[model samples]
Target chain A: MDATTVTTWMREIETSVTQERDRLVQLDAAIGDGDHGTNMTRGFAAVVQALSQDQEAPPGRLLILAGRTLVSSVGGASGPLWGSALRSGGRVLGDQATFDGPQLVEVLAAALASVKDLGAASVGDKTMVDALEPAVAALGRTVGEGASLADALEAAAAAAEAGMRSTIPLQARKGRASYLGERSIGHQDPGATSTALMIRALQRAAAASS
Target chain B: MAIQTKPRKFLNDPADVVKESLAGLAAAHGDLLRYDRAAQIIVCKDAPRAGKVALVSGGGSGHEPLHGGFVGRGMLDAACPGEVFTSPVPDQMLAATKAVDGGAGVVHIVKNYTGDVLNFKMAAEDAADDGIRVASVVIDDDVAVQDSLYTAGRRGVGATVLAEKIAGAAAEKGASLDKVADTVKRVNERARSFGVALSSCVPPASGKPIFELPEGEIELGIGIHGEPGRRRAALGSASEVVDVMVEAVISDLKARAGSQVLAFVNGMGGTPQLELYLLYGEVDRKLRAAGVVPVRNLVGSYITSLEMAGASLTVLQLDDELTELWDAPVHTPALRWGV
Candidate 1:
């Protein structure tokens, strides 16, 4: 995958978040402030605007720009969570014009760690980590098995979707929802849902390139 | 599926609520405040008074009279208002910090929410890069939840108002940024708050309650954002509710017999001032029975949610310095004394 593929991923995320805007807001409304949808939509729109202004940037630079935009535009916990992830991943990618299979997997691992560090949340906390950690691990496993980049992303997206669904039965251990305690058990995590959306966007972008 | 009842709010477009609120604030209190639409910051007209430490505090917009209303002489130098229930971005804070920084430097009075803390940390770093000295004190006095979505520890609630007043007074006295910060930290340590929500508040943008409370039920330990409380219990009489809120706060603060404290009974926007005064009476009675003296008291809607029908009680054990600062002249829209 190259810079165009990366840009495609960002574009796809913008579209997907826009389409799922109400759903994400409803999910957050169940346990949060109900602005996740609005915040994510605004953040992605800003990302697209920033990216468009500098279309010829390297893949790493594009992701970094998107991350910074999210951090500044989205004014909630999700801003830092998603922003630090992409920023750390972009830093590791370090001006790479192209993201090969191993480099993509490396970015996923680094991004996951960065988000976890910023949020202090881990898997089973019923946050974005519920989706993100699994997707990263699935992608790592698939790539290690010699799968193509598209196949690995597809597998990761599937894992993320499953992880998002799995949040339905777990009580939240972090975020505003945790204040609900046992009452938070039945709702899907909005952060995890958005994470799944991003993973699916990545998979679609990779397949489009193939 | 049943039809959902959308909350009724008086406003134009939700998008323009924050902008218009600032406009109204600026219009009403132009003598005290100057609003910068581009920067979304409310600045004291007399900010950056030479050689005085400047104080800045802000959060999401719904908690009105909080950050913005507290901006003036002997209080906050500036307030950065974010979208409702969302943290202000770094740019807003950076601008406020820079615009208000006197030669004595600027101090950020940040609430303990994750978003606010992260954004303020970023702004402080950004200001440092610009050669503006910045220090910060994080207020985490809500003892209801140990850690919640936006906080790693206690949530900053009522004490934020008190901290701003006391610290703002310290700054006005020409204290160094470090000294002002130390005073703010001490204020935070000496304060504790607990809140109960009789109903949920709907942000203008969401157009729905953040959470649902069954009829005749109350959410105890509720945060200012209308976030879920520590527990949901059957609604009780005003005295009962005040008992629960005051007792929990006292226990959390370990208030023993003969402890002199400043008690604040804060209205959560929708609640009437009459009810807040009633609640304050109950709180005062309980503290006296527990051998705690209510030395100074503030009863009103200073820090509030947007039309959330609830109240929070804050207990601040005060020393001589804190009491003196609290009594210091403060001229602001929401709070005033010794003017």
Candidate 2:
């Protein structure tokens, strides 16, 4: 994908996150800290502003800027987690003027590893990793099966949605959800829900490009 | 219950109270701390040289001595202070990362609250964009909430202090950022906490209680935000209160025989140390009987709820590394040891 296309995708994700901001926060209020929507919204808004101002910036730089914006604007645990994911992903992409499906996969793998390294949270922790791990795995699987970028991302988004749904019955082992112990079960993870939104945003971006 | 009125006169505008207080705090404790008033960054005066992984944390005001008082050698590299009860915006945290981040990346330590977590994450992203490697650890130790349908999950409480202390030492010992993050995650896994609120905290600006509670009633498992607890019951003696709080914490920890644990008896605010000590005494006795060895102990107001009268307990299973870090010397305004 080219820089312009990636930028369009980010803007679409920002819009989606804003549209569902309150819903995400509502979900979080049920079983996590009640600021997921606000945090994600603010971070993406910052990214939009940065990208608008620096349209000439390369794809890697744009993603890096977006990551920084999230880190600075968001204030919950997810802020850092998502911020690290984006920043690590951007770093892996380097200054590439454009990228392909395999390139995107490589970047995503690095980003996921960075988040895992930083949060030290595994998939079953019932945080965003629940959604992220599945999405990444789906993307890898699609590519291994020789699917196009659009197909892989579509599959990833679906897996992420499934992962988000799976969090409903999980007793969180990470972040504020863990504090609830048994109480944390039976509610969808707000982070997972947001992760699905991010993946869906990517799908939309890829479709628009196609 | 009716609200009580009191004279209010301390410094400049109420909006600037926290900033002014931090200024005075830094001035008084300059020997032990280095304060960046503009950035609201507080670090150990004699911080270790570059190359050591830096541990930084932050949150809103009123939880004084928390993100601030915890700054010192073998503790936090920097502590960013936000507005009262509000998460520090991105600018403050970004400034903190730049100030303390040596060539070695910085680790941002955050609490479990949505605002705090989100803001810190933004800051880490900002740092990385600036070509600084940054990692973050979120602490969610409260066991008061059901973690279910009614609220936004569990709040970060007592275990935060212990996590910072232990994790800070680990970073100081030259652990990589990834390693420190892992250690922090391990501690979070083993730690559980519960709290009680006897009174509500009044924000500095409004000077009004966030919520109301009856004179003879206590809110069980109340969050730091004056959120309703699981249940409210008639107030009981200090020992009885300890029994209820300890029971919740122990059960949450899934306490079993021979578990080595770290116990912290933390005051919410107005609760005096005398009462805290008594509560700790009861807690210690019960823990001993349960066949759990209390490895490291901290008693005082490490975390608070404005001027609320209450306390919380955090119990974390300990290993050799955590115990050693816990035992390490830390010099901060609120907590001092191994001096």
Please name the candidate that would achieve the greatest lDDT relative to the true structure: 1
Per-residue CA lDDT of candidate 2, range A169-202, in tens?
8877776556556667788998889899989999
In model 2, the Cα lDDT at residue A8 comes to 84
Query: TM-score for every candidate vs. truth?
Result: 0.96, 0.64
Model 2: TM-score, first chain: 0.97
Scored by Cα lDDT, where does model 2 land?
A: 0.79
Q: What is the per-residue lDDT of model 1 for residues B202-297, given as tens digits with 9 covering 90 to 100?
A: 888867778788999999988888777878899999989988987898888987679889999999999998888888889999988877899999
| Candidate that would win on DockQ | 1
Against the reference, the lDDT scores of all candidates come to 0.89, 0.79
Candidate 2 regions off by >4 Å?
A1-210, B1-11, B148-151
* Chain A TM per candidate, in order of listing: 0.98, 0.97
Candidate 1's displacement at residue B297, Å, is 1.0
Q: Best candidate per TM-score, number? A: 1
- lDDT tens digits, residue span A54-75, model 1: 9788988888998999888887
Per-residue error for A83 in candidate 2, Å, reads 15
